[model samples]
Target: MKYDFIVVGHGLAGAILAETLRSRGSKVLVIDEPKENSASRVAAGLLNPVAGKRFAKSWLADAFIPAANAFYEALEARYGQQLFFHKPIYKIFSSIEEQNTWMAKSAGDNWGDYILATHTQSINQPGIDDPFGGIMIGRGGFLHVYALLDLLTEDLLKQELYLPERFDMDELQLTESGVKYKSIAADQLIFCEGYQVVHNPYFKWLPIQPTKGEVLEVQAEQNFSPECIYNKAVYVVPEGAGRFIIGATYDWRNPDEEPTPQGQEELSERFRQITSKQFKVTGHWAGIRPAVRDRRPLAGTHPKYKQLSVFNGMGSKGVLMAPYLAQRFAAALAGEEEVMPEIHIFRYLSLYYAYTDQQNQQP
Candidate 1:
C-alpha cells in the first residue's frame, strides 16, 4: 500500500500526472470515484490552435501543441489506441467586419503561422451555406477523451495502481516523515480534482471561477468528414459514422454540472444556424470547467502543507494545456526543474495567503 506519490482524481490532469510519474519509475497510486462528473469525461477534446472570435492563437500554442501531439502520439503507440487526431478547423465568418478582423489578425506576426486568409473551401461534407464565408485554421483536432480515459483506467487497473473509491480527507495523516492515506505513505499528495477543487479547503482560497458547460451528442443523417471540426457559434465535431458532437454553452453564473434546458435550447439553436440538415439528439451532458479568475491554470504546493500540491485550472483548454503543464509539474515534483513563473501557483500566493491571513487575523 506504499507509494511514492498519491494522486487524487482520475480526470485528465490526474491521469496524465499518474502516467507521467509511473513512466519515470515512480510508484504512484491514483484514487478516484468515477461517479464524479469530471470535465475531461464530458469535454469534446478539441485542441484548437486559434481561439475566440478574433482567432487568437491559443496561449503557448507553439510550445504546447508540439508537446501535446508528441505525448498523445506516444500514448497511442504504447496503448495501441488512437488518442489524438490532427485535423483542420473551419471557422464560419458571420459578417464582413468579422472576416476583415480575421484577415487583419491572420496577417499579424502572432497568428500569421496558424491562420490563413482564404475563402470558403469545399470539403466532403453536407452542403452548408456560408454567408460571410469561412477560413480554415490548420493544426487543430479532437482527442478521443473518453477512449483515452478508458484505456488509461484499464492499464492502471491491470498494473494494480488505481484505487476505485472516494478519497477521504479525514483518513489522511500528515507527519514529519511523509503523508499517509490508509496503508499508503507518500512523499507528496497532489490534487488534480478539476472544478471540484473549489471544495478543497487547502486550495479553495485561490480564485477558481468554475464555469458550467453543456454539450450534446447528435446523430446526423447527412455525411460529414471527421477530418475537420466546424465552428460557428457552436462546434460541430464529427464523431465517426453519421454522428457529430455539438456543443457547448458556457454558463458562468450557474456552477451546476447538470445539463439545463436553457443550455440545450441555446446549443440547438446555434447548431440550426450552422447546418440545415436534420439531426437527432442522442445524448446530453454537462461539466464544470476549472476556470480561474485570470483564466490561467493554478499550480503549486499548499500554503500550510508542504507535501500537498495542486495542478488544476486548465479551464476549457485542458486538452492543449494538461500534458505540457503536467510534465512541468511532474518534473517539479521529481526535483528536476522549476515550473514556469507565469503559470505557477506561486504567482497567486500573495492573494491567497493574504486572504487566509486575514481570516486568521480576525478578532
Candidate 2:
C-alpha cells in the first residue's frame, strides 16, 4: 500500500492526528494493535483546571483548556455525538486552611475562568457532605473519549486506511525519500504509540515515563445532581443511569495494565472519605500513561531520520491536549509551522546521542 503518511497507534493522539491530517488533505494510513488498552480508553477523561492540594491552576491550563473546548465542540457538531461533557467540578474542602486558600484566590467569583466560587452551598447535595464547602470549578468535565475514537476508527476503516496489526520494527527500511515497512510505503512515518514508544529503537532514548492507573465503575444511588463532578481524595464522576466512574490509583512502581487488589483498596478507601454511600463495583480498568519527564507532549521529527517523527506523551492531560497538539503537529509536519519548543522531540536529541555513544563504547 502507498500513502502520504503512515501513523502508528490508534489511541487519542493518533486518532486526533489522523483527523487533523485528513482535514488538511493528507492521505494517511493508521496501523494499530487493536487489542492494546490505550491510555485514552482507560482514562476517566477528567478535565480539572484547578487540581492538586494547593488548588492553583494547572500548568498551561490557560492555553490548553480553551483549545480543548473549541476542538471537541467542533468535532461534536460534525459527528452529531455529545463527546465533551461540560460540567462543574465541586472539589471538597479537606480543612479550614484549604477553604481559606480558595477564599484568597476566588470567592463566589467568575473573577477567574477556573475557579467559579469558594465555599459555595451549591455543593451540599444528598449523599455528599460539605461542611466546610468546596470550590466550584468551571471549564471542567469529562470527554466521551471512546465515542470520539470509535467515530474516527470507523471513518478510517470506511476509507480503507485502517490497518489492524502490530507494527514490526524489523520489517522497516529507511529510504532516501521515505520509509518502507514490508509492502507499505509512505512519505513520512509518525509514531503515536503512547507508552509503547519505549520499544521503538529510534525513539527509545526519550524519557517516556509509564504510569499505571486504575479506575472503577460503580452503580451507586445518589441524590446528588449528575451535572457536577465531585473531587475529594478521589473523583466521583457521574455517567448517568446511576452509574459513576470512580477512580483512580496512580501506581508508578508497577506500570502494567492490570487492575490490582491494592489499587482497588486504595481507591475504595479514598472514596469512603468522600462519602459513606454504599456502591457496587461494576467494572475495573487499567492503562499505562505515556508521560514525559517534564510533563509535556512530545512531537517533532527525528534528528537523523528526517522522514520519521513522533507525537506522544500527553500524560494525565492527554484528552485535553491531543486535539490542540495534533493540529500543531500536523502543521509542523506540513512545514506550515514549527512544533513548539516545549514539545519538540528534538529537545531529547542530546540524550539519543549520549545513548548511542554508550552503545558504541560497550562494543
Stretches > 4 Å off in candidate 2: 105-111, 120-122
Q: What is the C-alpha RMSD of each candidate to the true structure, in Å?
A: 2.0, 2.1
Structure candidate 1, residue pairs in collision = none
**lDDT for model 1, on a 0 to 1 scale?**
0.83
lDDT of 1 at 327: 85
Model 2 lDDT per residue over 184-249, tens place = 899999999999998998899999988898999888766646878989888888899888888877
Over 1-363, each residue of candidate 1 has an lDDT whose tens digit, in order, gives 678889998888788888888888999889999953568888899999888795777888988898899889999999887889887888888778888887786666555546554674433346565677788888888998888888999888999988899889899999886799988899889998888888887888888887899999998765545667889898888888888888788888988889888988898888888877888888899998888888788888876788898988888888898888888888988788887786788888787878788889989
**In model 1, where is the ten-residue run with the lowest total lDDT?**
116-125
Candidate 2: Cα lDDT at 61: 76
Clashing pairs in 2: none
